[model samples]
Target: MRAQRDAPVDSMGAEKCMDQDASPEVHRFQVLVSLMLSSQTKDQVTHAAMTKLRSHGLTVENILDTSDEVLGQLIYPVGFWKKKVGYIKKTCEILKKSYDCDIPPSVQEICKLPGVGPKMAHLCMDIGWRKLTGIGVDTHVHRISNRLGWTGRNTKTPEETRVALESWMPEKIWSETNLLLVGFGQQICLPVRPRCAECLNSALCPYGRNPANRSPKKGSPSKIPTKNGS
Candidate 1:
């Protein structure tokens, strides 16, 4: 899996989801917002939305002052843009009044925000606070972990996979698992009709070990809507 994780991972991923030149405080906020917009939205779409928001001023103050109509326009086309407009506005207010314009420092605290879940909270802590509170199990992670049998059983949800993985995975690797597997899932172990033939770990993978499943023929479902919409 590591072999498949090449330069492309660095070129496009969670690392590039924020503006590095911004002040430390604003940068952290940008990371949280980007993660918020990333749900059910592709990286490219989320990146584009962030670019628009930054151009118009992406600070918490600016988002709060902007009307829901204008804010929706800036982040248009992101999955659930209308709902996100409300979440972003409400979350910003909480951050300003409670966190002094910064995101919550703990995963538990972050999850308390409206529209936030365990996945977003964990990712925010990792990317925003540089602390790996837990694995950020998105669709890719959930699907790939199940495919590889890493979760021990067919975990039905991302949250289930999170608990299963954290139960035994090393403490040090908690942070990189999401990044490592997301790129792998995007490239080889795709959610739908995965190219099992090309996977280096196919020999050991449970799904790949099945003779009929290994190298699907053409005309099979090549794509399916995933959490990332890949």
Candidate 2:
């Protein structure tokens, strides 16, 4: 599915708001909750929902006990809150009955639970269990990796990218790869007018040197601030 050593890798990891003071279990649950909240939603909105959910007690039992109406109200700021509430409630029940009220550590097992697809399962397992069962190909990881010539093709779906990336990226790097790319995606390598000159991996990136980025006049103001300042 992929060739090894296709692209040179740099020290490409980043610690974002997600990694602060969070234990392994909390990180895993945060990944699960974030995946749920991220459906048709932005990261900031999902983070806010998780914050509110945490304040209201975020155990499996507690989450299951939350009424859909209340859950929807609490998560209304995110996209598709009403639908997400039902998925969350159902997922909690599955966790309690199938996994002994604990989130499963296995990526395969986690995928069996409701509302958890391969990408979500991988994210949960990596962050929650610190196990990189597979590469997590979120929008950013997929987009940036392809643009950097790490993968053979650009993909519209996360699953496709996951399968493709697994062939290229070593298991050791899988766990932290998404975290790094997501941060870079959010900050420098954005969808529009990416700050190519300021990108850390600019030297190794194919897209960074492409004509699209070099077309604009020199000394143009950066679309975003530096990571440290921002």
Candidate 3:
């Protein structure tokens, strides 16, 4: 539980990368940009890159005016920085020309942006636009869902996991699922060698209940459900 409390996602995730006191439009754009930069990248790295970009003025016009090499350097060390550089530039142009330097207003339009995937689009909608259009399924949510027997390992992709979850889970909890599972994965239910012994669900979770997966560690998770609502 204490471990989960200090997971990087709690403070360094994409949702935490925005400038709270910025102008409304700039704040929304920063939220979208943060999600765009988060894919396949660790939370701390993305947060640092966002800090640099924010310091240099994280606006659509500013990013569009900046050159690729400099932008790459600003967002350096994130996964696929070279490709993200192009995504950022092209998305900024689209925002300026089509949306008038603001984020797209809907999930469908948001997904059309370069380098922005379904996961980013959903997160952008929820955080940038305050719309709970769908669940944002990243690696942590996808893996943890399966490990907890929610998906039965049938879903091969994050998108599939999202669809499966939305098909049954209450719409009200969709937004909470991403953050909860992401932090859980970062701490207790890790991708490899998970600390099942540290999880409250270890005695009940399918994978955690497995003898081989449980570690002889001493800790506890923060009120994780054994099943849907236990």
Candidate 4:
């Protein structure tokens, strides 16, 4: 998947924010901020928000110096923008006072920050620090994994799906799994009307094998199995 196309926009956005001449510490700090702004937000929106933030100096000091109203304006349209501003400010304050203005590298320490959860913490560690703490499960991963029978269909949350997947998925693919599955879910295994016929895994997928799982083609007979061996 990495060879097929560029990495997802959030990851790419983080890299874009990292100046070539910037120190490793600065790059990690920028990446952490990017990941924080990305929660419950679309990749393009997150990219735009980061770009706007960068325009005004995307740094822990700059963010803390900015007023909440200005910060909200900069990151407008992101879900819970007001709430996120508070979280970002609190996180920057922690980094400045406790961590000496450097983003913490440990998952436990990162998770202690406001608005930082397992998914965001894991993603920051993986992308910023090149550490594979855990799989970063989002809605796409949770839905697609259940649809593909990779996890129990009853798994109702991304965290549950993450645990179930880690139990069986090979350790080697842990870092790349989220990216690959997220792309697959967006382009092929869509939530409403997946492109099953075009999927490479269609033949091997239980959900894909059942034509009834997909909408019947126009003017075609229903594929749903009937009782009495019809």
Candidate 2 residue-wise lDDT, 114-174, digit = tens: 6668878877766567666787777778788778877687766778778888887787888
lDDT winner? 3
- Reference-based lDDT, each prediction: 0.85, 0.68, 0.86, 0.77
Q: Highest TM-score among the candidates is held by which one?
A: 3
Residues 1-230, model 3: lDDT tens digits: 53335678888987789889998789999998898888889999999999999998899999988999999999999999999999999989899999888898998999899988899889888888888999999999999888887875668999999998998899999997888889888877877768776677887788888887775544444344442334
Q: If scored against the real structure, what TM-score would every candidate get?
A: 0.90, 0.79, 0.91, 0.84
Worst 10 residues of 1 by lDDT: 220-229
Candidate 2 lDDT trough over 10 residues, lowest sum: 1-10
What is candidate 1's TM-score against the reference?
Answer: 0.90
Show how many residue pairs clash in every candidate, following the order shown. Answer: 0, 1, 0, 0
lDDT of 1 by residue, 26-88 (tens): 998998898889888877788888889989999999899999999999999999999999999
Candidate 3 runs further than 4 Å off: 2-4, 216-230
Off by over 4 Å in 4: 1-3, 6-17, 216-230
Alpha carbon lDDT of residue 143, candidate 1?
Answer: 95
**TM-score (C-alpha) between model 4 and the true structure:** 0.84
Please provide the root mean square deviation of candidate 1 (C-alpha atoms, Å). Answer: 4.4
Question: Candidate 2: misplaced stretches above 4 Å?
Answer: 1-30, 216-224, 227-230
The TM-score, computed over Cα atoms with residue i paired to residue i, of candidate 3 is 0.91
